[model samples]
Target chain A: MAEKRLMYGNHALVEGIIYAGCRFFAGYPITPQNEVPEYMSIRMNEVGGVFLQTESEIAAINMLFGAGAAGVRATTSSSSPGISLMQEGISYIAGADIPVLVINIVRGGPGLGNIAPAQSDYYQATKGGGHGDYFTITLAPNSAQELFEFPKLAFELAEKYRNPALILADGLLGQMMEPVEFTFEPIDPGKLPEKDYALTGCRGRPRRVVRSYDLRPGKLEELNWKRYKKYQEIIKNEQRYETFNDKDAGLIIIAYGTCARVASAAMKMARDKNLKVGLLRPITLWPFPKDKVAQLSERIKDFLVVEMNCGQMIDDVRMATQFRSRIHFLGRPGGGVPTPPEVLKKIEEIMGGGR
Target chain B: MTKEVIVAGFGGQGIVSSGIILAYAGMFEDRHVTFFPSYGAEMRGGTANCSVVISSSPVASPIVAEPDVLIIMNEPSLLRFEPRLKPNGLLLYNKTLIKSEPKRSDITIIPVPANAIAEELGQGRIANMVMLGVLAKKTGILQLATLKKAQRIRYKKASEEQLSLNDQALERGYSFL
Candidate 1:
């Protein structure tokens, strides 16, 4: 039987990572996302998994990098500032083409910002917070239920691409509780893709070298091209998003994570008053569903890009529409999340006079 | 149909736990539920609250601007949430803490002495359970048995004495209405 229970988003995410065959976890405590590691501290022991309270976010990501390169399904979670500290390790992990899962339970930021929900990390997560010409397959889950599914999906995608997959969640989703049932079967770690490049004891076989450094002049450029080709494949085959009430929508709201959930409520409110508004929520922030938005932009005239940041995803939306569709941005920079009524007001403002 | 509820009170009043219990009851009855609690500085002994939305259909948003059921456990919460209650909504408050009555005549207000009832049961900390009892009976949002079942599940890990005291508080509060 399918397991059903009420779970906080952070707890569900920890359970999801465990169910997805993660045998190693290392992270530091941070607000909003502290529950993720807290739950792992207890539950990981119960599952016979290794859990580490690392010294810092840098140490945690490097631990994950080591575990991931050793062909073990490993994970690490942190909030925005902590994730910022993991960028160098993430860049190395990507450069080495290792499969690992990184979770960012995003809070307000620019500098030691408050621990409230924010989607300001869109650029940081999708546009490569790490210094590299590579991308991580990023999944944004709006609810605790989706929190259970995305970790498994993230692991699978990471293994398939031989690169890191990130789960980008906000403080609201991480802290909120909702009913969740594990929709997928627990993945067997033994059945997962075997990394031929893993540094296992050789047993007379050829030893594998897994490092980010490539000193040879042309060799480094060739390695970057290989990474770009893999990114293109992820972009082509892994783009994911969801559309609601868009068939006849005169206005479309582009949002993700917490903003998408609020926009869904606003969509219902607008429809009740007979306003033709719709919502397009990107489930995968990187490898974003630009084609779907482009297809809709041909039919829809007005687009409202709502976020919890000072307008980051708006750039991607404009790029998707080729700057042809009428676009308006609604966002709060730091801790404030726009409520459903506020989003409904934005919808009306856009429909009233293109304002 | 969707029922949006806001439970508010000072810190340590079990404001967020009350919302969680209500949501658990809704889930027990096979309804979709969302529970969003206040975070950050508001959690440090100041006013705290949580929003719960129970719906027959999928809950769109957890943010409840105009709640159909507004539960205020203290005077500050009443002042903060009273104006936001929808017209013809159900307003449940603790008469023990809130001395004044609600200003709105458009809604149904039920003032239960939650603290007094819990004190009678020898556990004043379970006042939120008392309010939950009144909410279940008055609004018909969840059946009495369902609420009790939810309480049992919530306190499954709690001590035996604590469970019985909560049971007494809930039944006493239910009978008060």
Candidate 2:
């Protein structure tokens, strides 16, 4: 039998990292996401792992890049502002093809916004916030249990693609406590495939040099094309989503992270009110389940993209639907959480208009 | 049908853990449950709150806006969330902390002197557990046995003396009617 415990989302992430054989964590604390580093400090020490609180987010991400380049499972986490600081190092990691897990427990932002939950970083996460023609695999988890499980999936995908993976959580999901069962068998780090490009002592072999600087312009263009092709492959194979009561529904709601949790309640309220409202919650923000939304759009007449920001993800929904469905946007920007009743009202208005 | 609730209070008062116990009991009864907290800075003397949602089906929303129930552990919480309660919802107020009477007549207001009762039971911090006992009795949301099971699970690592005192506190609250 599996041991069940009521754990907060940050603690769940720590457990997930441990289960995924992540032995190193370097991060700077920020609100909503601070518990992850705190939990890692105590738990990592108990498990004989290294948890370093770096001087800054930039140093933390660079440490992660260094650790990941050495062929070790490593991670770093922060909220929106801190993640912004680490974007440059993240771009370097992507260019170097290093597998690192970066978790962003999103808070209200643009600048040092409030330490409250918000999905305002959706665009930055999905569209590659840093300067590059590169995309990181982004996973959005709405529940604490998914917060626990997503790190494992993130690590697997990061290693498989040799790319950085992001767990785009928010303050609400990061702070929540829920019963979680850690029944999966522990992953063995020794059993993983050996990396050929790692910096671990290239004895009696050709010198290994990892750099993004290709002095020849054509060589850099070829490298960019190679990375873009990898992103295309991920777009095809890694697009993931969860559909609830969407088979026969007329109105479909697209949401992610904390917003999805609220939308789920709205779906229930709509069901009770006898309105046909369903949900298509995307777990992967990048390589976004666009094909699934496109297919659902063919049958549904109306679509609503609900988020915590001022219509950041609505563009993605519109792009996915290709102007086929009547798409509407509802949001509460600047750290305000949308209530279920508010979402239900939108669903009712949309259904009444027959748009 | 399962009802979702949010209990708000200070950190040392056990409000968050009490919500966890209710959620645990709900899960034991095979109901879907979630407990989301507003801790950190709010926990250090500010207004602390947690939302617990229990449903017969897989819970749709973990965020409780107009909760079916609200257990206010302090005056601030009552003032903050009283207006957000659904009409005819259950409101359990700790009379020791909230001296003023509720203004609403639409909802069921149960004024239990939980803090005073816990003090009588020799543990001031267990006031939230006392409220839990009253909530279980008045709402019939969980059995006393299930509550005991939850208590044991929560305090399994504690000393026997602490467990006994907590058990006495729970029973005293439950017997207070």
Candidate 3:
């Protein structure tokens, strides 16, 4: 029998990790995202997994690096402030090419913002999330069901590319509860590619060194170029997005995660009023689906980018459209969630003939 | 068709659960649904609210700006959200907790002493269920069987005694309606 259960998005993440065969977790508790680690602590113990509450966000991410280098599925999560502390470790992990799942349940700010939901981390998440010439596969989930399903996808992408994967969730998506249909198929941990590069105690083979060190500048540059080539391949093959009502749409709204949900509502209301507005929601933020946006720009006269931050993703939209279409931006910064009416008003105002 | 609702009350008043049960029922009825709650520090003593949207098509937005229905378990919630009700919308208020009456003429207001009725039913917490019962009777949005399934699904992990109390709460709430 198909059963429906109400679960918060953080709880859904925990369930998704379990479903994805994640066996280790190391994280520091932070506002709006502490529930993820708290739930993992209890559930991990019950399932014979490991859950460690580290002293700091830096320590937590380093612990993830250690666990992931040992070739077992592992994860670490935090908010913006905590994620800032983890950037150094994230950079190291990205450099070492270790597959780890990092979840950032975003809140407001450049530093120590309020606990309210915000998408201000868009630039940080999509711009490699750390100091490196590498990319983190970022999945933006808009709802509880997506929260439950994206972790599995995150793990798959992380392992496939041997890179750090991120689920860029906002506080609103993390806290909301919705009816979710859990997938029944169990993820096999053994099915993942054996880490030939992992340091596994040197059992019977040559000791492996998992570092990004290079004695010569040319070698380091070569490695960076190879990583960029891999990213290019990802951009070509793994850009996932959803388009709604865009077949004959006059106005196209580009949004992702929580803001995308709001845009969907506005689009529905506009459609009811016989307005030719549609939505293009990006599920994969890094491999940004630039081609899809470019294709839509050909048909639509106007493109509106909505987000929880001030013109973060809009930069990417502009780059993709190459200023071909009239690009407009609507957003709510500093922990405030924009209502559907607010978005609708912005849409109408933008389309009301003032360029 | 989509029925969007906002249920608001104190933190411990089971307002979130009421929204959850309704959304679960929607799933049982093969409708796409979403339920969203206010979280973090606001969940402790502040007004707790959850938005539920049930629809024939996939739900577009989980946030309700102008809700089609308002289930208020307290005066604060009633006063706060009464202005956001669509024209001719249904308002179910817990008369025991909400002493003041709403002055909106366009909306149909149903006042029920849900807490008092639940107290008589041997538990005050079941007031949420009683409100749900009235909502079911008034809207006929989901079948009783679907609600029963939802109860089972929600209370699957609880002990038998706890499950029995929840079952009784649903029955009493339905009968009151």
**What DockQ does each candidate score versus the true complex, computed on alpha carbons?**
0.85, 0.71, 0.67
Candidate 1 wrongly placed segments (more than 4 Å): A353-355, B42-45
Q: Report the C-alpha lDDT of model 3 over A145-183, residue by residue, as the tens digit.
A: 888899899988998888999999999888877777786
- Every prediction: chain A TM-score: 0.98, 0.97, 0.97
- Full candidate order by lDDT, most accurate first: 1, 2, 3
Clashing pairs in 1: none
Q: Write the per-residue lDDT of candidate 1 for residues A211-300, one digit (tens) a residue.
A: 998998799999999889899999989889999999989999999998898899999989988899989999999999999999998988
TM-score for the B chain of model 1: 0.95
Query: Which numbered prediction scores highest in DockQ against the true structure?
Result: 1
Cα-based RMSD of the predictions, in order? 1.6, 1.9, 2.4
Model 2 stretches astray by more than 4 angstroms: A353-355, B43-45, B152-158
Of candidate 2 chain A, the 10-residue stretch with the lowest lDDT total is A346-355
Select the stronger candidate by lDDT from 2 and 3: 2
**lDDT agreement with native, every candidate:** 0.90, 0.87, 0.86
In terms of lDDT, the best-performing candidate is 1
Which CAPRI quality tier does the interface of model 1 achieve?
Answer: high
lDDT of 3 by residue, B71-142 (tens): 999988888999999999999999998889898999999898889888886889878877887777788877
Could you tell which candidate, 1 or 2, scores higher by TM-score?
1
What global local distance difference test value does model 1 have?
0.90
